[model samples]
Target: MENDFEGRPSSEEAAASLRDLGADRQALADGVQVPKMLLAALGGVAAWWVAGAAGANPGENYEPPTSGWLGLVAALVIAHLIRRETGIRFRKMGPRAALVMAAIPVLCLILFSISLGLGSFGARWAVLLTSLSAFGLVTWLAGIAFRSALDQLRR
Candidate 1:
């Protein structure tokens, strides 16, 4: 006699079929999604930090609070865009990329400090312009680097 379950697939088999049809290997391996709230909160914190940095009066003449805010916003936007374009999580980008990304901000900070040392203009304005230009350049370079790295990884 034939068993009642002879024609029926096991639950595991059905689940495997659904997974094959609906999900990619990568999706199953490492789930990824836009971290919107985290990004927004990071932007807000950067804005607040820039405001405080601007207020510190580093003994220069070009005191512009908005400049600091703009630079901070630009960096945050760049980081957010990078995260969106790459499925690679920030933590998973490896120490090398993390080191490079970290260095970009530190270099910007160093430039700002040097600009302030020049003492030709308001410290705030000098720092803001220096930071914005440096960060912008670094962000552009980083986009290229990330694309290249992703290409290499795909192979």
Candidate 2:
């Protein structure tokens, strides 16, 4: 006689299917890669924002650094480009990635503040150090965050 569940998958078949699905997820995760150029652009923008403090007039005639606004816009554009290039919009990048992402701005702000202080003291040349710091730190952190995101996908 024919079995009532003839059309249904057996337990072993179900397990195999699940294993294939897991392997597919792993393959997709491995295939996803962030573009290096975008990360460099992000670093450049971060450096520019911090470097803006060099030309800023602090104290008495403090003309607020307008480069900050421009930098924000540039950053947004770069982020859009990155998303478009990657095509993987992560809903949750895990806590490590989140922390690293959060740290980028904080680090930039610190560097900007330092630049402002140096500029105020007529140490305009020092802004270069801060700008370089911004570039290095931002680029490094961005890479870490991307790796963390990839790690999340592996799970």
The top-ranked prediction according to lDDT is: 2
Query: Could you tell me the lDDT of residue 79 within candidate 2?
Result: 81
Q: Candidate 2: deviation at residue 23, Å?
A: 1.1
How far off is residue 25 in model 1, in Å?
A: 10
Candidate 2 local lDDT, 37-117, one digit each (tens): 899889999998998999888898788777888988998998889889999888778999999999999999999889999
Would you list the clashing residue pairs of candidate 1?
60-122, 60-123, 61-121, 61-122, 62-121, 62-122
Tens-digit lDDT track of model 1 for 1-155: 98565576789998987777555643523444444444444444443433345445554464645666666776567566656654554335445556665765566556555655644455565556554555455545454445434433333
Error of 1 at 27 (Å): 16
Q: How many pairs of residues collide in each model? A: 6, 0
Give the poorly placed runs of model 1, Cα more than 4 Å off.
1-57, 60-66, 83-91, 121-155
